[model samples]
Target: MQTQDRTNVSSVEAAIAASQNYLLSIQYPDGYWWVELESNVTMMAEVVLLHKVWGTDKTRPLHKAETYLRREQRSHGGWELFYGDGGNLSTSVEAYMALKLLGVPETDRAMKNARDFILERGGISKTRIFTKFHLALIGCYSWRGIPSIPPWIMLLPESFPFTIYEMSSWARSSTVPLLIVFDRKPVFITDPAITLDELYAEGAGNVKFELPRSSDWTDLFVILDDAFKLAENLNLVPFRQEGLKAAEKWVLERQEETGDWGGIIPAMLNSLLGLRCLDYDVADPIVERGLQALDRFAIETEDTYRMQPCVSPVWDTALVMRSLVDSGMTPNHPALVRGGEWLLDKQILDYGDWAVKNKQGKPGAWAFEFVNRFYPDVDDSAVVVMALNGVQLPNEKLKQAAIARTVAWIATMQCQGGGWAAFDLNNNADWLNLLPYADLKAMIDPNTADVTARVLEMLGSGNLSIDNHSLSRALDYLKNEQEPEGCWFGRWGVNYIYGTSGVLAALSLVAPQSHGNNIDRGAAWLVSCQNPDGGWGETCFSYDNPALKGQGNSTASQTAWAIIGLIAAGEGTGKFEKDAIDRGINYLLATQQSDGTWDEAYFTGTGFPGHFYLKYHLYQQHFPLTALGRYQAIFSK
Candidate 1:
């Protein structure tokens, strides 16, 4: 793993060899790898399947997962992301059920603590929308109070304001089946289930409600106790059948060959449960395929057990290789060349959902995977530009053509504010963000700090740099984006740490060395923010909650990201750089598993900070490898 033994070899070739090994070890025998995305969703999907498939009577994987979850409960008696101090409502409910599934008694100290916390926080009625839906199924909460997303919603035309495509990928997946299940209204009851009266707000289920005046859709589903009493008296079987049929078709149509629905497990689990409730047998091909997919998502450790949203070795490996090459690893090295080829082939030449959202661009961004058309984010494309710059392409004409096309595509996406949003530009209409069931807060937009820094860095590579209005505007955006505290805000990753790191990297290229510029100030802010653990971390709550202030336990991936930013700024010789470099390198070298991987369970990336976060398992390994390679190049020499 040492960087010194390899010399004069192309970084790409060396990267390919190393990445192949890395990918191979993680790949399941069934031909896929799983990564933890967010904590609550993964645990929820797994626990649901544990009860529905394995039966609630046993104490094996469910018991182990429950024990792990209970140990992670915060002082307030609920779980946060990655064993943090504060509790999130959705996370607590999901963990509570996983414990319940394992036959943990309500009188148990942990269970009692959790129940008290839930009651204190306005009860389960005030939990996030999705959590309420799950609680309703087990009779813990009443379905009447949940927002009205009637099954007829599936009948809404694409031109309608509430078309499925407008929703985020996660929401679309879950909403479709929820439409079916709610229409059927099959309430699963057991002796262990808690009643709505015991768990929700007093008199909550009986209360009548109306749509908020600001809602965009004219149709809203609300059920007063009087309204439900009247509807239940009238038999409407045919209408319910039609709604269920349409929703079942919707779910089956979207299921991937690999049994993924929107590449998120919650959608798949809920949809499969809906199908079974619709009387689809266990032997059904859809059910069989659905069950197999779950096996690929689980991760087992000696101390913890959990599942990831999806696996992504391809994306992680590419960025690590580029980081190493940028730090003077040779372009011809085996690892770099192999990684370059892998990435080159993965680029999206044809537009997908991103282009559809952008509405006016040619599709030329790098996807997270070889063929995922649903969510091709912008950060990966910027990273691809950096990676492509270092390796030699087999087809020079083709390479130049690809670079030109991709860079132009990114350039057009620059917003009025000068930064680049990941998927689309300037899509910041708050009116369009009115999903009642989704937990995501505000989304990333063109002014996002992380996107701006990445694009600026990529453009600095000479081939992509344009001195035109677009480039100048982008520069102005980055300059304007620097916070009064000398840090930038991270939209696609965590909080200030990610934002400051991104700003430093971008300013290093945009700010000329001749002028003493904001780069020094930005770098200093990053150094000041480092946690006492000799590593850097940022909490997801920083997206809108000013109170969180980028809080979290230190993690290796963020630590490496900070160091990489400093090195890219040409401060490799400074005291701050030296300390960061040594700490990051040592953390990686010491924590690496016997198989050359590292498992840092905390999420270091955010698709929409506070709204949607991800845990790229390989990020722990590849990012550190890249950072250490760069540090060794500068200091070891």
Candidate 2:
């Protein structure tokens, strides 16, 4: 047993050394880390549309992007939102249209196969609202076929049922500009060669836009949608001009100095197109700035190019800094100091939309993007505070002030259910999801267990204790939110493992004595769900189906999450815990690359539940290192 313990200790130490060195090697000169955030082929398709709308002859780049899209097509001839998932209808339609515009013939085998798959899945008519809107812009689908999203939504007051403040930051940022495009209904007349008629099914013409009557409240929203359409047709919308001006002002105000709106592809693209529709010349400084900002998202290779969904330097740096410190790096190490300084500079000291619902807290939160001051998120703020607290900075007084302000701000963002959302405080309005334009399924900013647990962990890391009212309420919320099978839903990460890990870690630090049973159950669940290879993985499909939770091929990141959760659950003395940790550590050691980092191709981050996903390239490196570090600290001692 002593010999076995020695082996385990050596294995963990080696992994920690390799991982730490690799992480340090990748740090930016400014002390940040950002890896490519990979998504579906839809980004490629959108780039094609952006070029076509602006009448640019970037054919060489377009052809390269088309090549990337074709390369990603599954055997079924369609693109999935993520790897190892079934083909998606909206992704397929958009890809087909983009390829057709790139001059791929209808008789091409790939195009023919894609057409068949789309037709069987109910054709272009069944695609998501965003895809339909894109088609409408190109004069393929009629604007009437798309849902009504008038600029007048901006005019609604806070007391109104559905105001701009009610939408999630991502949705709100994108919608503000989309309202302009929808009102203007701009159609850039492309060459006669570019048309989507060949991609649609025979009976697509008969398809009509109708409100989904998923429930009575939904039925009412449908009626409201119809009313809005009537008002639009008859020019009866109240404050129409005022609403348009307000929306334009809103969009212009949020456009980041980087030129992108909110630093996201959708918002950036929509804002550009919206400005164009409003008769802002292409040479307008804002339009020019927007074009320049988009150039940053594109990655051009010799043969193909891909666009990032968004940059994540701020978020990545915070996580990496935490991992490095947790892995036994000194708090005042040069890298640590640089990261701390960088994060301190990124802190938002001005009010954002989150203030609408949370008017009391002073601004000290952090945004995921470098320049999205109008929309700082609670999750990023918590992580940044935790990192700032962990590191020893030269300006200790300033760091403490930043931490205190962030903690206060996060407390204000807590909802009635004692949980925290990503961006807004209490932006939950389920009825709004019933709107026809909400096919993306991310309408409101409801509190989630994963984010709430993260906040708890952050608070616990600081001077806050379990006796604090905010921490106590959050504990109760987490207890009630746990699944019967003993895992929590991961709203931002892959699935149950991520949530369970986050909750267990936070509880261990904040309320360990009171959560014995919860911790044990979560530990048992993690042990039972371990893959045969001694690692762990969870599919994004788990978001849509609960039974699939904690089920998939083993991955480095998910496996690390499980190991860390078990360690936090007081599995120090148990045989199962000992065995599980041993196996998990060996798996990491076996999988580590020559450069000391692990390779992961799977999509582990959640964007909009079932509709969108993300692959944070740095996740594989930082998380596994943290897990190994924690294991060594407890067992090696």
Candidate with top lDDT is: 2
lDDT of 2 by residue, 1-637 (tens): 5897788788788889889998898888987787788888898788788877776636337778878878888999888899888799999999998888788888999999898889898887778888989998988888877777777778888887768888888888888988889888877886534677755665656656454457655677667778888988898878788988998998888877779788789999999888888888877899888888887888888988888888898999999998898889999999999999999999999998888878787888899877888888988988898888889999999998888888878878889889999998888887667678887789888989899999888877776643367777888999999999999999999989999999988877777778878888888899989988999999999988899989998889999899888888874224348788778888888898888899877889988899999999999999999888888887788
- Which residue pairs show backbone clashes in model 2? none
lDDT of 1 at 525: 69
For candidate 1, the TM-score is: 0.76
Q: How many residue pairs clash in each candidate at the backbone level?
A: 27, 0
Q: What is the C-alpha local distance difference test score of candidate 2? A: 0.85
The lDDT, on a scale of 0 to 1, for candidate 1 is 0.62
Q: How displaced is residue 142 in candidate 2, in Å? A: 1.6
TM-score of each candidate structure, all chains considered together = 0.76, 0.96
Best by TM-score: 2
Per-residue lDDT for 480-562 in model 1, tens only?
Answer: 77787677777766667777777776667665463135676677666777676667777766766865654667777887778
